[model samples]
Target: MDRVDLLPPPADAVAHRADAYAAAPLLNSLLREVAERLPEPGDRPVYRLPGGRLLRVRGERRPAEPEVRTAGGWRRVNHTELVKLVAEELTRHTGLSNHDLPAEMLDSRDAVAALLAARDRATAPGDPYLRSEQCLVTGHPHHPAPKARGGGPVAAWLPYAPEAHARFPLVLLGLREDAVVEEGDTAALDALGDAPPGYRLLPAHPWQLDLVSCAAAFEDGRLIRLGTTPFDVWPTAAIRTVYAPANDLFLKFSLDVRITNDIRRLWRHDLLKLRRTDEAVASAFAASPGGAVWLSDRGYRTAGFAFEELAVLVRDGLRDHVRPGATPLLAAALVEGFEGSPLDTLEDPAAWWEAYLRAVVPPVLAAFADHGVVLEAHLQNTLVAVTDDGMPVQALFRDAEGVKLLADVPRAQGWERLVYCLVVNHLWEIAAALAERRPGFEPWPAARRELARHDLPEIRALLTSPTLPGKTNLLLRWTGADGAAARYLPLPNPLAGA
Candidate 1:
């Protein structure tokens, strides 16, 4: 019975994968909706994706695929364009626009022409991860030869190619921790396999030598190779490390002392910040009609420190706003304000605030209320992507470490400190920045009205609906005027049901 079950999936597992296939089209539909809603571009070239989705271009031009619509969808013109398009799309999606183009496709007109001709016959659809020949990397990852034996660690590092490549896709190459391998121990090194049809690994950079680690090896149901922990190289920092088998994520780790000074000073008082963000997102979606527009594949988290993952902005962010002469105002705003740079000083304050309120705040306030919660929607933490014409297209709320829900607290006083953070600190900062351009710009009434539109229904229904998870009390202590000794409002324990 065990062999029979192990030989093939239990049918139910296969059915679940089949469900994933069935659900993909719906995800494609959401991508289509977001594409359609993109503000019209002024002058930049817009490239169409597989499902009629579009992206606005920016910066230096790289080669792109020449595609024509077919009965099925967009088909590539030649192999060169096919490969070029995949690289460009990945570069754009990952915000790694500055990478140099691979040399194979450069300097040869005949090669380019041949590639264009071969595109359609060579590429295929349904490979969302771009597993086709179009995305093959031709070079090996840059890695140094095995370190000198003896004096350093107790063991020798060795490399072996795997029989099946994808099974060990994350084979790491690098330095070992303080402890070295023993002479008799089996050496651990990255193993490569026979090249698949169109893919190759790029070599590691010399500068990355400091970031290297020993490869971990595994076989059967247990580990055959044990590598040193990453903490060995960079110790004393509170690191937030995340791995997505597919999507690229951002990691920020600093020494514990640094985190204590940077984040904990202000936020340590708020233990429930993480819980509040999750609860607020859940409540907001619960209140929506069909449901809120959220990322099923992405969000924020904290292990020793805070971190965000699978940033949707990396793929769909600001792509449409990269037009000539148009600065991405929101990214510009954060980069400027936080970085202490300002956009051309807006001489007209009213014009700037009008744009801020209309473009930035209303949509966020509306969405927050629609979800039956409040957001720590501040300028430093919020990114607004606007069209070339200075129209706001999307607002990305970040730093879940700062999010709080109104329903999670009781009494005006309990919620006051948070409201101050949202309204006085966050919103006012943007307002003040806008005021730099337009002296008379005031957004108080407009903002209040917009927020009230969302908040009133919940305020009215509160008595009928039991109070939500009281997760904000822990977060409130941070902003209270009193020191850590301040009295904290007792909240009903949420785990009581457990």
Candidate 2:
């Protein structure tokens, strides 16, 4: 957990590091989603594939340096070989062959290599919050291809990548008054730049502009290209979302590229339902205990002709919602590790973790129990604000597009989604990271105490359940399932025994 100042690794070393970074999540998915665990005596635990091939890895949290048993004895597999092995095993396991996912796995590894090279040359943001937002090099630890930038050329996406510490100005555009379709409060868009008469000011992500075709609209006088914004915005872990400090605003845009499970676009259906979901979550936060806040997605603006591709959502910034004198950091980045992470220098791990639970656990549970609002309270969507002493004080949650209400879905289904996001994805990763830094620290007991205090009907079953729902991102993508439609496999529940 000690901070170190070391020179960047050489090109070959960088490639190796990238392979390790990219392989961890893919291995986690393969082990969790398909491979069956086999009893082994050595330090490395072995898994039996559907084809009866035995595989073993070096670590548990971020499994690495994979090796498979063959006629020549144990043979090491690099990221590329690992991808091939996974593909063949998945085919045997699912009775379906997928050619695209293997390519994406390779692309994800190559993207990591490019990010590592760019990060070595670029300067990280001075602000700790921005640092947390941009520090996710190994993103979505349960995903097979978290960093695949739609298999685009490195040159096309590198300049906009958050992992590269890249920041740039927004490309301003003018949607002709008659062609503009807007909902909610979008006054912030006009403040970014000015548009000529008969046009409404709209802001577009520059990378998205490259991916989407807006030339026809521009030529037909439906859309006009205004100059770029005067200020630069920093891309957050959600690559399409950017933070404008001067305006104190967060802008979520529709990018044509598929980053994780689906194409990262602001779909028309989700946008239409955004207000209801955001309002329900915002109300839930208002009624909950403690200092938890909901960073509201106020509104959106887009061209009617290209609704999904051109939509830009305006989200509440940190200034208003975050507790005063506290710096907010992305929850996922804490697990990933950053230069200014409190996990590295905390004096008391137990106290720090207790404070984290108090700040994060209550609102999420209360929202689901009392208000029937299921928030996507995963690591990426939640931010923990810490005091100067590195003690967590408050939690802020965002992304209305991911929110679901009980009216829309059955209660059991909503609870499952909440448990997956809140416990499995958010708390479990933080516990693992904290335990990795401080060996002997048991995080589950305190987590159990926190949940036991809640009076929800589901709490009893949650604490006693032998397994928790773990999303199958690998199988979901391989089978071409809709990203929003989540499928879960059972994972051993630590809370059950705590």
Candidate 3:
């Protein structure tokens, strides 16, 4: 059977020291079988190929290639080509080839080395989410070692309660034997304190971890300490979840896997848009005196998974708890427009944008300047919280990975998904909001140019800014609105000439 054995423990494998993982004999055998099939069995193989496992056979007939559909499109590469690629990659990783090894193993040696390297990384220290554990946390400290305290026996604990999960039971750190600590466990408690700032602890539910395995008790039992395990919730891509762990702290998780390539792509595209948004908002804040600030993120993590989690929790959170037809900002906007339709009719195009911009836009721009960071500014990436009186009180921004500096433009040589998201998805949402307020909004092209000017000065200077392409035209309304003939009054850009 054609297969790949992914997890196997070597003589000095790192997993041997980790508490969560054990050896995978089945995987080891699978890898060896695949290695035995190599055409030239005596050659030494290189290792740690980037894309996938590959090895070239001097005389063995190549297998048929499989066509796989990816985001970019369908891509197909036969086993022979893949093997050569892997062989080259192996050389890149180990800097050794078959000639470097003894002649006795020439045909088989190289393939074995390549497979071992791939398996090693697949089972390495930082790679805890291998096939063995789809969503598992590693127990290794990623910090400076604390001085060994020979005080009374104590245990380390990290308690996590999912507020959105019906206040799910908390996960407590305990000992390997699951022994309960009576008194000296204070040190562990001191380290874990209640919760991080801007976050609060929630009451634990019955299902959560009742107790945690502590290092103190483990050390007393002469056991090696496993490091801190970061508690996380996993979800598939395509879903945005709303998560409330405890203490009314709300978080959004996108269901996407983060990879080095993905990070580079986003850095290339979205980074500049964010930078432009920051500068434009900076100008806006300089103009408005009473304007509040919008919170924007500065760093970007591929929020693919976080988005998924956020979607699920959001739907669930609002299903039974959120009040119907009681949007705080819209309700207040109704009070502002005494002659307009009721707040529920906010779906009306012109009225909606007016309400959105007046109530939401100013502060968001101000926040961009205040933080000296650009916000993706997309609808789902943002939160508008209201006070008891239904006024837009807090604009919460999350997903730092999508945030970037105006000065740090990524090379277009990478991917443009990041740019597509910020310039296309995020700006589109705002444009829609603006269009709903002003039907004649049509400055998307100019606005697009302005955005490039503000955020991507480098790129804009290099090439003419692309024409703004979208169904809605927001910039036209803001910039070209006729003062006397316009039904809605447009806010003049304070930095228009400059």
Candidate 4:
């Protein structure tokens, strides 16, 4: 690997990452729902925006090398130019100007450049699964500014970045028993390290501690440092969550950074509702027809004062849920196109896709239809385990915080969220990735069949729906809504025809 120095990356490296970072979401929003296609299609399909502005991109699934029409033919749009173009397009189309989003759009591109530079220099993890977990350079393919890392310095977040294939020891802190506030089963935290008689062991994300100011508390002896973990923990696709393979533990920490929709902190409200939501979904999977597994968020531990900042959730790891021989891979990594992704190397794409859908789809749909549990079964939260032949045999889901009970949302709203997450976000991306690699194999027919087998009324409506609810990430950010607050626009549903 060509190592980029810690100081500064070369200009070309900067441009490449920036272009990739900016082009993806801009292309995604345009191609998926916005752009008007030119009559003839070629190697590079040209799209027309409102007011007759022309846009062209390199590829379909993960669009790259964006270009726009200028007075002199087509001109390549850099990250900055693309952001301006997006802003202009959105303004013209929506009749609104979001000044903040344009800056964030630029920041996102710059963040990608930093990640790329770091990856170039750093030695990526050798383990295929870890590698897959770390591979998310594109990130939230539909979002305008997916890689924007809090608009912080490269040094601030790079060490903990999964995209950079970073693995480091957790900063172990000893919090006074009286000061530590926790609920549910957080016994797993105690096993990480020992503490004095008056203190409890609390492992923290080193990067998080740096970002949050707690020097006063540390100086006053409320919190004590007990040194870093003896061994490194592999950062999963979710940058805040790390997997300690030695202990078979998944540790999720509160990150104030805006990842996708929200500032990905383990919020108190979510924590309060966690057990209920997790239990309902877990029960559904346990009783469901398929042998799908729910990697439960057993419990959480945090400092009394720094509730969200210092919070860390303990989760069950792959050992308990995954089959003995089958290897677990992040579904997001599969869609994002990782090194060992089954989608990439599939010899029989159709059969593999069928197995994938069979393993993943039933449990998600069943959880909603039978158990009144709405799981955020997006790519990041879903894990599909493959056999020796890379055939998906089991689907394991995680993240209780994202779960919503039917009691919380009405039936229609819950169904809409389910369809969006499952069909649009998760399944659509997988099918697209599968098609991208294996050209002839169409994944939607199998997906349609999978939905057809299920007797849910929503499933029937889903089959015939002209357009699926596509989340408007760019507009969401532009309008400055809460990240989890989803706003949808209709996209031509592949399931309608296939």
Candidate 5:
């Protein structure tokens, strides 16, 4: 398959594209959360909003060009109007008002416009892996404000944005030996740059450094600037995490800005429990069958004075886990569509999907059933390594910070979280993307078969269940719920009949 030539569109074209991209997720959330589906027989599904307004949109997977039924007739809703409608409806539905979320929705749209413009000026990386890592334009396709950058100015966040195909050198710092707080194996930091005799080297994400205030520490000689890395690091889909091709290393840093749900900061509580969660996940993957790998979050380095702000996590790179001759691509990027996607030219989608299932499904299920480890196997956290023929050969799972152990949480709760992340967020999107490409392709039957192959207690119920848990991002954000606190609403289960 040949890579698509992404020529720069006109300013108006870019704005139009940005509007569609931004509105899709917001419409999806509104339809799923606060709106009731009305019995309409047309290609476009009509929904009754909370305040009795009728709304409709084209397509299902990526809903676009939303329209509202006014007194006169059907009227188109732009990104701005959509955000306003969503806010008003949510207020009526929830009987609560939130000023921040509405602002975030607008900010998200603006961010998309900025990203599109920046991408027009930037050159996408040639490496398939890097391209996949950086190719999430309409991120978290169900969130109302997926791309919102904490309402920061375009100049503030554009340089670090993954959607903009950004790659920049890491800002290196030297923390005084006494103020340096680290755990596990963070030896990779030392290799990036050398520190003075009394200081320990710490690599920082440039954007994060800009967001945080470490001037006091610098002035007191507790921290010192050691310049930037010689080699540039490619920002992955997770903007805070950068991949250094030279060392085959991944460094996850703390960025205070919120991208999707929560602020992209390495909180102290999570960092403290990181090793335990990572080790459990590693153990599960090690004992599991096949080549499915867990990219371990090795350790972290930070200044004791600013633990969360200064923290940087060292992750095991792709070179060791990825199969020989197989290229690893971000699973999310596959759904978002990229230059070198296997879905673009699949001779046999069923076989390709089966290979994908073989690589992705079993490990996640086994981790939950056999090892009592619930991996957050969402799209962003997964990598599908494919052969030269574009068939999936392996699945690499990462991000220990999101992993939950059944020992800590109730078994049922862990299972629900697992189901939401693996089945709903990950598999459903892939299945939808595939079915979109090949009309009449029933992805659910194969999904059902693969799922039924497992003997877990929940397997039977999962297959027969009328609905699956779909996280209510819109409602959650509207209610000002904790980002980590996942609240789910039932969504029609395709696997039930399949």
Candidate 6:
């Protein structure tokens, strides 16, 4: 055993991560929705909430080390105190009582502390792409408790944490051939490894296996172990979806943990409609110009007995869609940052921003207008491939699960959802990151130009709308609503008149 483990933990580690973890979403919600900025006092940004409650934070990006006005004035608020402060202010500001979100806030803080500790001891992946995928410590710019791992004990989920740079082999199983329920091209699964004559190969995420109860399946001869994979797979930002570099394939699993607003499970309803949804987006990309590709959810395989629990989704890997010389990087990592992120040492912010807009915006607009396909082109679902000099070469999108066809939703509703996902959630966040790094640089003009190029009627309104829809994640989690049933509040539109 390590001597450091024997020594009963340090105070600084816990407090530092907790403050950082707790501050971001609270600051995001407070500033974006409730608080009004009261000119910068020195270097720090200060805000005045309802009833003149003044709050200030140390920095931008992942705002840390919060301080608030008190009887003594300008006293530092710890994580616990911060949670109380958020609850109090929100209650008064929104005319609502949310007892649950406060707990999730604390849970998020505690979870961050756990991740930080685990990362300290863990070894990072050798592959830079994998490193980028795992680099998101502060995920979901506007989400409260983005790192909250279902409020479970540390050991229960720590090993599966992408933030900790964890990479482990999949738990391979042999489900009887009769029990295999599948859709689309699952041939890649067969190529993963061999299965016995009577059985079919089904690779499972180890963490998911641990969470699920499967003794009956194992005992009834429906499922049997066929040993683990020879090589390890890197878990992406979406913890349940892992990349196997050796096979050049992606496998998504059903995890029960609540990541952001929803329990990360591959739902049965989604599984049933996967082919239709993926085909629509795939056809859209096929027709669209600008080298934008769709990383299709090619197929899914699951056991009939434990359908959802055993379900595994197979998606197109980076090898297939990524341009020959260019490297594909997670769009979220471009915002969150990784070692080799093009966003980190951007030589020319304007050129970079334009290239980014060219890559991400066109296909999305084309898909919506031409094919009536609404893609959830949020940061996590989009991948931008860059050239040798870090200029974006291509944009590849994934996750058919979130696609909403215009035939299903009203045209107005689909457009609203598209604008929120593509512009507010994806583009605006990246723009803010670039702006922070290169002061006096604005990213919205180029963004506006890109949208105007689409010639869609929605683009005209999008440019003029005083407010953009921002997802109300904190409120959603507090109200205990379904994740797909997204509710939005208006955010001051930076795109307007830029």
Quote each prediction's TM-score: 0.35, 0.98, 0.30, 0.94, 0.98, 0.94
Over 82-142, each residue of candidate 5 has an lDDT whose tens digit, in order, gives: 9899988999999999999999999998998899889889999999999998888899989
User: Which parts of model 6 have CA positions greater than 4 angstroms off?
Assistant: 1-14, 38-43, 50-52, 93-99
Q: Comparing 3 and 6 by TM-score, which wins?
A: 6
- Number of the top lDDT candidate: 2
Candidate 3 lDDT score at position 155: 23
Q: Rank the candidates by lDDT, best first.
A: 2, 5, 6, 4, 1, 3
Expressed as tens digits, the lDDT of each residue in 98-169 for candidate 1 is 222222222122222222233323422222111211211110001000011111211111110010011112
Q: Candidate 3: which stretches are off by over 4 Å?
A: 1-167, 174-246, 250-344, 363-371, 386-394, 406-423, 430-498
Mark the regions of model 1 whose C-alpha exceeds 4 Å error after superposition: 1-249, 252-255, 259-348, 363-370, 405-408, 411-414, 440-498
Off by over 4 Å in 2: 1-9
* Candidate 2 vs. true structure, TM-score: 0.98
lDDT of each: 0.30, 0.93, 0.28, 0.84, 0.91, 0.85
| Alpha carbon deviation, residue 329, candidate 1 (Å) | 5.3
**Clash count, predicted structure 6:** 0
Residue pairs with clashing backbones, model 6: none
Decoy 5 TM-score against native? 0.98
lDDT of 3 by residue, 1-498 (tens): 012233346653332222111111111111222222334235423222233443322211111222333466545543233434334443553454532111211212222232233333442212111111111121001100001111111121111111011112222222222222111112222222344333222212111112222244335642222233234332111112223322222222222221111111123233324435544444544444233343322222111221111111111122122233332221211211212223323444443333334444444434433444455444434444433333334333444445444445443411132333334444443453344445676535444344443343333522243332221111111122231111211122212321
In model 5, which regions exceed 4 Å deviation? 1-11
Which scores higher on lDDT, 1 or 6?
Answer: 6
TM-score of 4: 0.94
